[model samples]
Target: MSFARYVEQTDPPRPPRETLPTMYDLPSENPEEPGLPDEFHDFQPELLRITFQPPTHLPEQVFSASDMNLYYNVRYPNWYKRPDWFGAVGVPKLYEGRDLRLSYVIWQEGVSPFVVVELLSPGTEEEDLGRTKRRNDQPPTKWQVYEQILRIPYYVIFSRYTERLQVFILQAGHYQELNLSESKVWMPDIALGLGLWQGEYAGIHRLWLRWYDAKGNWISTEAEQERQRAEQERQRAEQERQRAEQERQRAERLAERLKALGINPDDDL
Candidate 1:
């Protein structure tokens, strides 16, 4: 059935949108699921969000969040997965383009995430890699949902401790792991690439996964761009100061030559 048919609410007297559990009503966090508790989780995903600039999408049309509940199943609306980071284009940054989304409800939004990232931690490593088996009565595993159900185009896993990046792309209705011959992998669909870079982020110097442009240049954050501009301005000012000093010295030498000729240096003034 079409997603619109699932949430059809034209009958006025009782609109399903109004009656259904909106993001507001759904539980934000599921304590039963194993959660990755690390400060790296906070910083890495934040960097992804800052540099996630999709050339084809407007700023308001791009939406991404970390550790946010993503409600995917219409049958069990309460079921959700909190990804380390997930991003989608062609969706409003705000829920319904007005309110902030407490959770991303697939039926209501009608858009599945284009990419989902899982930061590897010891607790969730097996499941994140889709190595765990689920019983018939149990809810589907993360891999099953992303590959067989949501069919997210790109699934990324980054390890902070190992600084390893493993990317899987959906092909033929299944995820085929891309060979990471190098540290970087390009996503032609998104017109960007993800790579491991050794740099200082959030005051910590280490290899962090970040996005790069089609030209293979790392995308700069707003703050990083601002700092670069300021440094350029400073260099320009310094060059101007040096030019003025050279002109002043030339004038002094001309004045000395005029004095030797017995001509008043101030006469030109």
Candidate 2:
């Protein structure tokens, strides 16, 4: 059956899980929180989906990496920020295989994402870049979370408004800025790479982050590849038409030469 038909047949129902206590293990909160910007709510979920891989286990929710819980008690009393995207290459598939979490708890899971990406915004930009100091009483800056706490190998930030992209690689226990050329940046650790490109994803025509092949080529989107194939077919048809026209012109010229020599062009026939 079609997905739409299946959903139409079933009734809407609540998930069979209770709301966990609103423990402030991290500084995040519902959109109702005061001082939270309006735009944050609009893009937070999309940012998460774009940054992380599709959940390996759950076919329903796209951002199941949150269940991995990368910040259970890594830095107690300090808040955790779930990045827009993250990847933990060598981590185990599941922890105990039950009691799925709503967020990553690093203490419970020994691994941290090899790469962490933060989507840039006015509120989070300063903290994301680590330019703002962590007030003596407040939680660690976004910079601290990726560089010191998680010790992630690669940290990336992309600004939607300005189309700016930045990369930071851990060197000597701290992050040092990596250079970008046009739209690509190199991350040696992942063996692959990351970059921002102009393309359509999920029907949205905007700049989006994507992985690259070993040769530093932007992996083409499925839609783009299909469009390319169609274009190639069109070009091949045009070439065939041109070749047929050329052959016809040559036949006409040969007939004219036979007439000029007073020879019957179709005598043999």
Give, for candidate 1, the lowest lDDT window spanning 10 residues: 2-11
In terms of lDDT, model 2 sits at 0.61
Backbone clash tally (model 1)? 0
Which pairs in model 1 have colliding backbones? none
CA error at residue 37 for candidate 2, angstroms: 6.6
Error of 2 at 165 (Å): 0.7
Error of 2 at 96 (Å): 4.0
Kindly report which residue stretches of model 2 are placed more than 4 angstroms away from their true locations once superposed.
1-72, 75-78, 93-100, 220-269
| Candidate 2 lDDT, 1-269, residue by residue in tens | 53224434553453332432222344334443344344433443344444443323232222224212246333242346666566665554443344444556565455677777777767677887889886655666667767766788888787777878888889988899876666666555545567776666666677777767677666565566788999999999999999999999999999999999998798996
Candidate 2, after superposition: displacement of residue 172 in Å? 0.4
Cα lDDT tens digits for candidate 1, 63-162: 9999998888776677677789999989999999899888888888888999899999998899999999967457678997888768899999988878
lDDT of 1 at 201: 88
Clash count per candidate: 0, 12
Residue 224 of model 2, lDDT score: 60
In candidate 2 the C-alpha lDDT for residue 1 amounts to 59
Off by over 4 Å in 1: 1-19, 31-36
